[model samples]
Target: MTFGWLITRYMYPCFLPMGEWYRTPMDKNGAILKIDLADFQPTQHLDIDPTHHVIVNGLYMPHTVIRHNERLAYCDSMAYRVEIEKNAPIQLQGFTRGLAMTDDTIFIGQSRMRHVLRIPHAFSNCCLDGGIHVYNSTYRISRFVSLPAQQVYQILVLDQDFSLERGGN
Candidate 1:
């Protein structure tokens, strides 16, 4: 199975002020590990492009990985990029983390990095905010809904019959 792993080549403090966090150089990247279940060993490793680390002020933290139509796809959180096995990374608008998909749509979670200093980049110029971005089958954003939260860590797609009023029974 493929697993998302944090590849931190350089060590940094667990906590730091916003300004310091941006200034500090941390070689953080993400990888997809192909694990051999029988021996619990990683048989292969696919690393995210190294250029991502140089383009962003923060780390290239990966959030989620899933199989879609027999292909692997994952999110590079702080870099705001999504990658499919054989496709180029898709640019996004925020600190992307959560990801969910239906037959014809994709949902990506955006988090507000309020305390962290962000340097503007080609992917996104607007300020990061907490929300869910909806995309169509072609991967074009359809809509965005802002939330009153600091971060959106995960997303779960529910069936048509699912209802919160029934307590998800």
Candidate 2:
């Protein structure tokens, strides 16, 4: 009824599949356990073994989840950067949560400030103020729109026109 090492490091090992448990050894606490679905099961692992692991960069206190194509991205609060598995570098800059992805653009909710940040797919850097900010493929801020703020919890891109409308049901 126990997986030995899996039970000591991970909780409820008998109830989960082998692949669902992620070995995030790169984390400061050790490893970061993950599941394919949020509701399928909770609780993961943190491998502190420094020899046979590679902790993810800038993922000390990850909080948000955003889908980037086939990859899942999120922000590490303690590390202060957006950490993604498939693209670019480890940490982007500024802590992030509430991830929203579109065809050519991506949006993230800033934890420190009350704003929804925009980072274009084409460009390397972007910004946000009150409403919205549009960025080109070159990572430059091209347009800005005034939007009402209420401590943004999350965002989602409906179409490719660079529009972020909040919807929670």
Q: Best by TM-score, which number?
A: 1
Clashes of 2: 13
TM-score of 1: 0.62
- Residue 11 in candidate 2 has what lDDT? 24
Q: Which residue pairs clash in candidate 1?
A: none
Off by over 4 Å in 1: 1-28, 38-59, 118-126, 160-163, 167-169
Residue 49 displacement (Å), model 2: 17
User: What is the alpha-carbon lDDT for the whole of candidate 2?
Assistant: 0.41
Q: Give TM per candidate.
A: 0.62, 0.43
**RMSD for each of the candidates:** 8.5, 12.0
Candidate with maximal lDDT = 1
Reference-based lDDT, residue 146, model 2: 41
> Candidate 2, residues 90-153: lDDT per residue as tens digits?
3433334455556666555554332223222333443333343342324733353345752344
Each candidate: what lDDT?
0.59, 0.41
